[model samples]
Target: MIHVVFNEPDVTVINQAIELDENLKGDVVLIRDDYAVGPIQNLYLGEGREARKQWWSAVLAGGDYDGKADSGEVDDYKTVAELVGTMRRNPDEIIWIWAAQNKHDVSGYYWLLHFMKEFQGRVFILYLNNLPFINEKGQLFYPTWLSTIPPKEFLKAKKLARPITLSEFEVDPDEWIRLANEGKQVRILEGGKKLSQYGEEYYDEELKKFITGDWQKASKVINQFLSKARQTTGDAYLLWRLKKIVSGEGYDVQGEMKAMKDFEVKQKVGQPA
Candidate 1:
């Protein structure tokens, strides 16, 4: 069996869980792209994928992860293609896709399942949506990220795995295709397999709330927004948006724009500190 996950931290926790339960042992595949925050139009095609890569280049330019967008490190298309090849070569093999209740994971699920129809029965999903689990403190709570759940609790999560249904295999891919054609840059989970699309600037207004007339380190503003906002994105993405905010009216900027720490930003002089 192959265990597939979306994020890096999840790989660590899943590995720990495997150590505790030999039955859960499998090669773990981490899909490195965050499908929730980039262009999806014709994503399966070479030209469309290149367009999204170029867009990422712009979003990541001058940030700490500069050039990462073009790097082979973030290639999900290649990962999925290899997974498909593996499944084709060994018909007896099975795949388990693990996802938590968050835009990042669910978006990945949508993108992944679209290509998994031929292996319907062989593909299983363990979606932790609205499911409660015991944390390290022994307190029960719903987790938005898989990495937040105690490694021992993964044994319990294992029971939730079920083969991807015929209905889902039919309906879900259509939904993903629709989302791709819509050509939006951001996706938000509405609930259970449902996603709503939004412009790339969806978080800009909320991000600006942290900026005031007093200039603050760009890193500080991004860190605070990630901590305080109900909805948040990666620091790199936020820093990109903050730079856009600085370039437009209503924000004052100083210092180099090479990276988050290299810059400072604030509300324009008369905007109130």
Candidate 2:
């Protein structure tokens, strides 16, 4: 058995759960890309994948992100290819895809399901969509990310796993195709499997709300935005947007724009504080 998760933090938590429940023994594979952002046009094809890589480079442009552009990072295609190869060689191998209700997980699920169409019966989904779970506080709550759920609660989550239906194999790939063709930069989960796409600037206003006339570290502003916003994206992406806003007339910026910590931002003097 193989477990697939979208978020990196989910890996440690799932491993902890596995230690407690031997029945959940499996190798955990993480898909690295956040499909919710960037251009996903023709994502299944080689050229399309290269284009998205270039888009990520562009997004990381003018930022000091530890030289991600030059690292030649392995993508989801390679990871999925390896999984598909493993399943092909061993018919007994089953795949369990775990996702939570947030856009990041939901979008990753949509992107991955397209590749696993051939193994319909063997592939299963454990989507915690609006489902209540026990938190570390011993209180009931709905988790938006698998990492947020306590390790032991995953024992209960195991029962939610179910095979990807034949109908979904046929219909869901079409939805992914539609989303890819739309080529929008941001995708949001409306509910369930439904996703809505918007432009890159979708979160700009929200980021701006946290910025005030008083100058603050770009990182601080971004942290506040992440903590307070109804929905959030990665800090690197937010920094990119903040830089774009700085390039415009809306905000004043000081210091190098290479990284969040390297700069400071505030609203213009006459702008609302």
Candidate 3:
């Protein structure tokens, strides 16, 4: 079974594919993030306006089982786990849906990145560009003074790498900041702290102190950023360094664990949560 994400711009295409395919195997877990503004915004704002209030659900609100949410407000569906339970009871195929126009969808992706750890199927992304090509009326353009051309600074933007397990890289945060500043990459393998060369057991213990222990979400965001970085730099080393930083934070060193862990500690940095 395949898990497809029909993120916005390409929703119509995804729906069309579903209609054309008489009998496609696997289930579809449709995830409509709060960022999915309806027809009005689509007609007016191409990429100018942020998704409406509903868009915050992935980052703030909870998930909703009913597609027909009568409450008028969105349930912040922050993690795939929230949706996974709903799909568990359904026999139909599952596919996670989000919209590209809404940056909030990235938050959903962050959630899905960690979901891979607990989820049993393969995950994939599809670029749906149904809207116009260029944004003519943006508030600001790319800062040419600091412009980093893609092909030279890195490679292409669209390349898929197999999800790397979080257990590979082993190092301290002090070391991690050092590596990140140096432009190196790390890709850690999957394993527990006891197996790690770095002594990170204390870090894990500290992580448990939070009310919402979301290390998985944290790792997912870092990986998402690193994966994109690796694609840009075309540097295997950069990816390798990321592995170290992610693995060292130390918890469940598996898929999605990085993201969840990162989520917990991010807010608490420099202050008590």
Which runs in model 1 stand beyond 4 Å of their true positions?
Answer: none
Q: Which residue pairs in candidate 2 have backbone atoms (N, alpha carbon, C) closer than 3 angstroms, thus clashing?
A: none
The Cα error of candidate 2 at residue 147, in Å, is 0.5
What count of clashes does model 2 give? Answer: 0
The residue-by-residue lDDT of candidate 2 on 1-273, one tens digit each, is 899999899999999999999999999999988989999888878898888888888888878574585575746777888999999999999999999998898888888888898898999999999999988888999999899999999999999999999999888888988988887899999999899999999999898898898899989999999999998999889989988887888688889888889999888888875
Q: What TM-score does structure 1 among the candidates reach? A: 0.97
Model 3 alpha-carbon drift over 4 Å, by segment: 1-9, 23-30, 34-73, 76-82, 86-104, 127-273
lDDT of 1 at 249: 76
Cα error, candidate 3, residue 168 (Å): 11
Tens digits of per-residue lDDT for model 1 on 156-210? 9999999999999988878889998888888888888789999999998898889
TM-score of 3: 0.28
lDDT of 3 by residue, 18-55 (tens): 45453433344545442212211321133412343332
Report lDDT (Cα) of residue 87, candidate 2: 96
Ranking by lDDT: 1, 2, 3
lDDT of each: 0.90, 0.89, 0.32
